[model samples]
Target: MQGILVSILVGLCTGVGALPFLFIKKVPQALKDGLLGFASGIMVFASSFNLIQPALKDGNLLSVIGGIIIGTMILTFIEHLIPHTHTKNYDENDDSSVLKKNILLAIAVAIHNVPEGFAIGVGYGTGNVSTGLSLALAIGVQNIPEGLVVAAPLIEGGYPRGKALLFSFLTGIGEPIAAAIGFFAARLTDKLLPFILSIAAGAMFYVVSHELIPESHCNNNEMLATYGFIIGLILMIIFRTVIGE
Candidate 1:
């Protein structure tokens, strides 16, 4: 129970991290794209290096691959269900509905966060504190852009700064809900653990490749975004190795 609470608090911190956006009048497009790209790189590297390789070491390559495919398919299915919209810069001729765009962005970010929190909760429940913390912090860091993604549209939509920021912050609450579910499920059945963790790894990989990478390209220099991504991966490796997660 304590572990679950801790996980929820950790997840909630991701939402709190968005508080700063309430004061920003305008955010730079290039900055958003660059950060998003960097995050994508981190997610990809983490999935491959940390998640997939570890599963392979456990002699579960088939499950790992299946998990990846399943995760990717889930995202693809969701994308088909609801078309995502980007928050474009305000222009005289633009017809974008800011509210609709932000809402969609929130949903997309929430989808990604659910798997992340699950990974964290499962890690902690199974006595893998280092792994859980690393995953949570990494996922949280990556979520900053998600907050911005939500905030930009709300701000553009003419909402008060506070309301926009509040909306952005609220979108990330799914992480804790995921954590609670994962932790409780693991407590109920240990055999299901590997599948859940692998599924999360797969989902995160899908999100990075399908969503974050493309968003990065849209808002920043591709080369710089790529550089940031590499840095994110390296940092993840360093943390994992040094912390022995």
Candidate 2:
């Protein structure tokens, strides 16, 4: 119960992060690319350290590998089923293009939040309130930057500030939902947690490679993107160090 409530608060941090955009009118293109790159870097770090590494420790290599493959395949299938355009030739004025882009971004963010919620749920499931709260705090802190990542693109794509913030918050709502699932199903899913985590990592890897990174580089802001990526990784490192794993 406590975990579920904390998960909701963690999810709201995404909206809190986007609050700045409400006052600021415009975001530079280079900055947008950098933000996207930052998002990619954070996702990559989370996938590798927070998900895959822990999975590897908890399960066999073969099973973990299999889970990753399955995860990638699942995301690939979803991508095909969804009708969305890449950022290469984005047209902000084109209503169809804007809608498609926002949809894809929202979906990617929601999927990314699932594993994070699971971690929170499992932490609480261990009967350690401190551990659960710690995980919640770390994730919540990280979520602030992610809010910017989501809102920036939407605003750039011509979404109203209120709509962009709403969308960003909506994407994060998945975390609490997944946390609820994880909390209730923890005992039943214990043996499968490693595979589940690996699957999430794979899904995130696909999102970074196929979605965020490409979009970040689309504007020829590769240098800014690269710098943003480094800073993002560093931020994650600092958070992990300060938060204690």
Candidate 3:
């Protein structure tokens, strides 16, 4: 129960990080896309290098592949069903429906948050507070841009200050929900944890390579995108090292 509360606090705190965007002016398209790519890279590295590789050491390759396929398919279908709201940095100018884009992005973040929170819960369940906190902090740190990703476009779309923040905050709720589910269900078992990590890795990798990188490059800002990716990677490395995970 204590662990669950901690997980919830961690998840909620992540959402709160979005509050800063409301006060800032709209970010440039190139910068936004670039940062999105950077966030994508961070997620990719964390999920792949940290989560999936470790999982693969203990889990079956076939199961890991299956999990990735299923996770990818699941995200694909959801994205298809939901309307996509491109970021402010879709190009020099973006004219897509902001509401639709925000909703889709929110759904994606929400869905992604679930597994992340779950990973934290599972860590605690295994009696590893440091591991759980590390995971939560990593995800939380990763989510700051995710919050920006949700709000920046909405601000472009003409959403009011409070509403944009509110929506961004709402999208972030998936983290704790994931934690609760993971803690209660005990899904992150020794046998199953690796597969679950792989699923998240595949889903995140697809998002970064397919969605974020492509979008960032659409603005022809390769340098900016690369910088963001490198920065994100470095930050993750530092966090991993400090956390000892």
| Highest lDDT scorer | 2
lDDT per residue, candidate 2, 112-185, as tens digits?
67766766776566465655665676567657766777787778666899988998898789888878876665
Which pairs of residues collide in model 3? 29-89, 84-101, 85-101
Using all chains and alpha carbons, the TM-scores for the candidates as numbered come to: 0.86, 0.81, 0.81
| Better candidate number, 1 or 2, judged by TM-score | 1
| TM-score winner | 1
**Ranking 1 against 2 by lDDT, winner:** 2
Each model's lDDT comes to 0.69, 0.75, 0.68
Candidate 1, 1-245: lDDT as tens digits: 65456555655544564666656667776777777877786677666655566556653767777777776777788788977855444242444554555667778887777777776676666666666677666776777766776677567667787877677666667777878777776567665555566776778887887778877776447787888788888888787788785
Angstrom error of the Cα, residue 170, model 2: value is: 1.9
Off by over 4 Å in 1: 13-17, 86-92, 188-191
For all predictions, the C-alpha RMSD in Å is 2.7, 3.1, 3.2
lDDT of 3 by residue, 1-245 (tens): 75577766665654575676656857776776667666766776667755567667778889789878876886787677864534543343435544555677777777667666766665555455675666666666667777776777677677787887787777767666667766654445677776666666566666666666765776668788888888888887887787775
